[model samples]
Target: MDPDGDPARRVRGHGLGLVVAPVLRDYVVVDIETVPLVGTGPEQDIREIGACRVEVAPDGRHLVAERPFHRLVRSEMVSSVWGSGLSSPSAAAVDVADPDAGLITCQAALEGLAEFCAGRPVVAHNGRLHDFVVLDAACRRHGVPALHDDRLDSLDLAHIAAPRIGIELRPNADGSMPPASRSLDDLAAWFDVADPRRERHRAVPDAELTVLLIERMLKTIAGSEPVRQLQRQILQTGRNPWARFLEPPPADGSLLDCLEADTARMADSSGLSSDPTSRIGRRAVHEAGIHARAAVRLDEASVLAPLSPGGALVTGEGRAFRAQQREMAAAVLVALADGSQRESRSSTSSAGRLAVEAPTGTGKTLAYLVPAVACAQARRRPVVVATHSKVLQDQLLTDIETYRKSIGDIRCVLLKGIANYVSVGYLDAAIEAGPEGPIEALALAIMAGWATQTATGDWDDLSISQIEAAFPPVRELRTRLSVDELREFATDQADRLCFYRCALDGISTADIVVANHAVLVTLDRVVEEASHVIIDEGHNLEDGATSALTETAGSVALTALLDCVAHAVSGAGVLRRYAAACGASPPHERVDEAHDALVQCRRALTELGSHVVDYVRGRTEVTVAEAASFGVSYRLRPGLDTGRAEFARARRAARALADHLRRLSGCLALEPPMSALGTRHWRHIESELGGAAFWSAAERAGRGVAPRPRRCLQAAVCVPRASVVEPSEAGVGRYRDIGRGCR
Candidate 1:
């Protein structure tokens, strides 16, 4: 056993006493150690080196018994340790006789390890730290990159294996938070694996012992079917490994308050109160929720089983949408079922893709949900319903809750980004900092309080316009909030704004996901990566995509900017009115330039509108492209030639605005990061929304197609044959239950 050998020899002896258990079928356990030389600094030679390798088989696990590689070199120069005290200690107490010798020996040991563990994934306890350092140092010494290959960490494995087992290597015996280093034997004993008991702390035997411990733990945590079920749930939610991780909170946190506050501030700042009846903001939010719910139901309906020849006999008064919803739901059901069958036949199936053009008020949410649930029940796949607006997401949740009561054992989860959930730690930080910290934090606190008061994060729960009265001014004072605070806020907000498509893409583990059209557009961009997509609100798809693809610098917007500039430059009271109307700061340079442009544009528009009215009154048919060109030339071009004087000034202002716009567009555009989350390419949509001529031009540009005449067409031609509006127009009763006298 070489009793009176060198310290490296002693460590090798100690390592040999350790036994390693195997985790994988063909597992190779490895350990590496490096020592820095004195005076040599970071660019020094290794003072000592040691390593070990072992393997396991079904018959029995055995350590490959070639003499464990050991080397030692005397340092030519004195050097301090590279890692912190948290790192492992060296093999010996005294300096080596020669550092070069140690490097040579270490090189030999590493060479042996490479040969031993060839064609195997390296297993190490905290492999990134210990093995990485040793290998990197060795590679540097050898004039070649250290071994580069797939490696697994036993520490991570341990966390996966025995989650409750809390083992800390540092602090030594006192457990008073001291040196943060690990010993191989200590870990083996702690984890109840074979102890090599080698007096010397070399690599090979230590690696063997680690392998043994990991193997035992793997067996201990092996599948029991029950464990697998638990694992699936954990995997699905991607939550904490401990206890029922899939469960959500009773309510969404603080979002309603923040939203309410934001909306009120927006209204106040923009002078929305003057009209009082202009419920655009309120209605936008509410209708978003209502439509989202309808969309989901519509999606559900598109998958349901079709009605018989007799159809569903009309019973109740409010059941107007039932028959149509059932028909739509049946269509979706056929899609899902056929899609599933097709997938069984091939690897991909488009059967689950259903595009329904149901109108807004037709109870589409139930329609979608019914068939979605049916498909889910049949195939055990989730029903994911997504909408474009947050308000609609809230409405879907309400519908889910309502449905849950009516239908038993229906599980639904409304997922937002991680930011939506309020963090206790952040709240504590804010509360500890007192009221002087960030206004955002303070606003967040108020929002948190409101969350507690309300049952859901629905803004409608709060009285309209009370948010500003309740929380008033958001603190403008500068505060150095910690990254933790910022992160908490960011994460919470992300949750609120997270696109449903992203959630679906991320966690395919769910049974149902609800989202909007933007998300569907995003899905289409990455359609190959997703499974079984159905887009509700089929009528809105083109328009929504068009809106996404287009941009408008309208007269109203240009006027607003000019108003701000006028306020800034001329100190006019009208400027203040502009600010009040637009909810923005007075513009300085860019605003002035924009104002000038807007003036020219308004004059041009006056002329163009007159021309258009004249043309419309004079003729029965008009081409959109011709009109758009006329409008653009007359309205937008004059401002262009009045250029170059303010061009530099505009450019200077524009550069900053452009940067801001780029960032905002990047954030909002359905492209890249945003597109993956449900933002469709807005540029394409924008091109379409530039009126009839633009759309005509775009189509012609793409396929050499000509534009259709833009005449005052009947709404009946545009409406689909399946549309209820179409049937009702023919003197058919449009009541909820259209049972008899229809045909």
Candidate 2:
């Protein structure tokens, strides 16, 4: 009832009256508001604790009582770090005391919240890391007892629940906008569960809204069989959720192993030697596979049966199949068979290419997956299913899991790039180095908690983006703490321990392999062997491929590279420092030349960035005209022309940058950061263009390449389609005539 009793909560033209609702079960939801305070140092202080305890009637259709608890804690300190993004709470909503109504201290607020919760399991959106961490830290500072032990993270729970309840949180079709996935506000809007307060960045409103949203989700999946398992998963999460990640995965035997044996048996029956090592046997198997796939009738495939309304999918999964899904599935089936018929081999992206314009709810995943798996089984080889994101990759694996029994159990495995796995060596080094700041400290703690519990040790499995959303700096920790030496992947005996090799080893036996587009484009052995491929998010294919193939350097990144070179030349780098300590000086004139190039590189980068910005403005204006609240995306279209003079100036600066690279290449390998840019920037600088690309690059560079500033953005060097050629040895087949192949 006391919606605005706390003057500390800035309304900011947002609030609404309460709308009471029922819950699926009796539960309590709590939200806490915190602001940085200059206590012993820059630490957070809880200014408010708002909680809602909901009880449903025996019928489970109505509410008993929806009790709300709110408290405003006194803020005695006026000093704190303003730079922290969290200080908006401090600046806008300071709880100052008045003679009429003085605010209570944080200790008093906690005690009151404990009494209000009264042994009910407390829930919060991102409570495990965000809310509970703040509370535990504050309790330690105040010497107060911990109030709650059993907690559920609505953030993690919502993700687990979304698919179980058939909610689609994937990106839009073109994928220009990322999903507004996990925020309490976004979730409320999606679930049609609104906070009447319409308020946020507050305690109780968020807590109340969290309860309504979760109740709605739980109710939607209540009749399903996974609800109990979902409930169990929801309970086990928060801080260290025990996932036996490193434990031996159960044998996911191939779904088509019997079929393979059957093919071998067929070869033997035909009086051909069944050994794969024999030429006759190899020919027999290949011909048999081709005939088997050719014989597959698209409309009657067993894989598609599981995706039908009157089929096992509906009978078992509680989800009805749509007609659009069947159409797409048949189309993919036709495309895969067509690719098998083609004389010229094509890249997985281009092979049997048919763009099905599937909107969000088209159930396109199952459409492609079932067909892809069927094709793989028919061919007796793996079918690679590629997605642009970990979200879809995870969803693909889940879909396979959901329909595995109905479709006849299939062996599938997820494979990510080596850099995605954590390096135990790097992690130990990071732990020994300790945290430089509070965010780093928190990030390390979260990583440590996840490291021991995670089986995959892959960044995506950890859902790193969630942690990074809370702390932006956490993104850097992926590589900073990921596998330090990728060469360790060469052999099992390699020193540094990482999980990527283990993941890769599973691919050989897998019937269907799920992977992100980045890994697929990188030309893994899986792509070479995969007889059929399904790119689910093909709209993002061009961009992902371009990003995988290009390297960009910005002024900030260029400056970092320069600093590395300078350190090496100035006897300050690791190698030079050792020489300096041994009383050996570096080459004097060569050192001076290196330093001068470093300075010139900085100047040229600044100049290039300025002129380049002016050049890119009016070339058909391909970027979105509407301003994004999130941020603007600037796409640099290829073949745009600037004035010859302007082009020369920019080109001169670029030439200077290229020259600087040549000089720095000799500077003790530019330490590591210069080489350590990222997988995208894997040093195409000195790489060979193999005669064909050199001329193509020269032609494209003449058209004036545009580089965006301070971003790892690529300069589009698109050439005439006819001029480009793929190496014959390249495992991927060339789409000589994509216009013929593409729909």
Give me the runs in candidate 1 sitting further than 4 Å from their true place: 1-317, 320-322, 339-353, 359-362, 415-429, 437-444, 450-464, 469-472, 475-509, 522-530, 542-743
- Residue lDDT tens for model 1, 215-307: 565443334323332232222222221111112222222333333454444434533222111121232222223221211222322233222
- The lDDT of model 2 is 0.49
Candidate 2 ranges with C-alpha deviation above 4 Å: 1-303, 316-318, 327-362, 374-380, 405-408, 417-419, 423-425, 428-442, 463-474, 481-489, 492-497, 537-543, 556-604, 610-643, 646-656, 670-743
lDDT of 2 by residue, 1-743 (tens): 22223212211110112212112245577898876565433356677888888764444342425458888777645443654444444433544324335468778887787788788667788886778877777777778787668666666545433411123322211111222566777667667665566777888778767767766654543432322222222221211221110111122111123223433454455553322211111122243333432234334445567766687765644477788888777777767765544333322334467777878788877788777776666666778888997777767766776556455646565666556676544453343333344345445544543443343556654544665676554565554455422442444221223455545554554567778777787655768877767776788997766655543334444443344333323322222322322233343344455556556666665665544443332232323232222222333322434334545554565566565555543332322233222311112111111111222322222111211111111121121111111211111111110111110
TM-score of 1: 0.31
Please report the candidate that would top TM-score against the real structure: 2
Q: What lDDT would each prediction earn against the true structure? A: 0.36, 0.49
Deviation from native of the Cα of residue 587 in model 2, angstroms:
14
